[model samples]
Target: MLHNKVEEVKSREDLIKFLLHLRKDLQTKGNAWENITLKDYLEAMEAWVEDMDGYYLNTNQPIPKQPSWKTIADILYAATMYE
Candidate 1:
């Protein structure tokens, strides 16, 4: 059910780096997240979840199409941690 491809990460460091940037992006955006556009939302979500590519990152599971409404809500829930 993994959404992401089977491509192995280049290294754990990369994963760590990706997560750091993701956290930073969310942190900087802060309350400004609401003003972001759909395209920006996609980009932010992708980067946060390792560029999801074709799947959701949280569970590393493939989504039927993009993601569900709950999915977005969950993302925001977790993302709020950056605040």
Candidate 2:
């Protein structure tokens, strides 16, 4: 379900929908999420961006040189719970 949402994010509107899905997920399963507060989410986002290349390398995916809609959505979705 979440994977489908990630793949569906092609436009700004789709990005917004994915964000809403994140919100809903957090509301329903926040205890499982790492970053719940706004401060935590912001800090996690910064850290994630700093180490994004490592993430790609570890995942065996090519590093993205440009920011696409999916990349933006991935960052936002990760920031919600990424440690």
> TM-score for each prediction?
0.29, 0.85
Residue lDDT tens for model 2, 18-52: 98998898889888888998999999999899888
Best by lDDT: 2
Which residue pairs of candidate 1 clash?
2-62, 3-61, 3-62
lDDT of 1: 0.45
lDDT of 1 at 30: 50
Clash pairs detected, candidate 2? none
Residues 1-70, model 1: lDDT tens digits: 1112112223555445444554566667656554255565655655645544333545676653655444
| Global Cα lDDT for candidate 2 | 0.85
- Cα distance off (Å), candidate 1, residue 31: 3.2
Candidate 2 regions exceeding 4 Å error are none
Q: Report lDDT (CA) for all predictions.
A: 0.45, 0.85
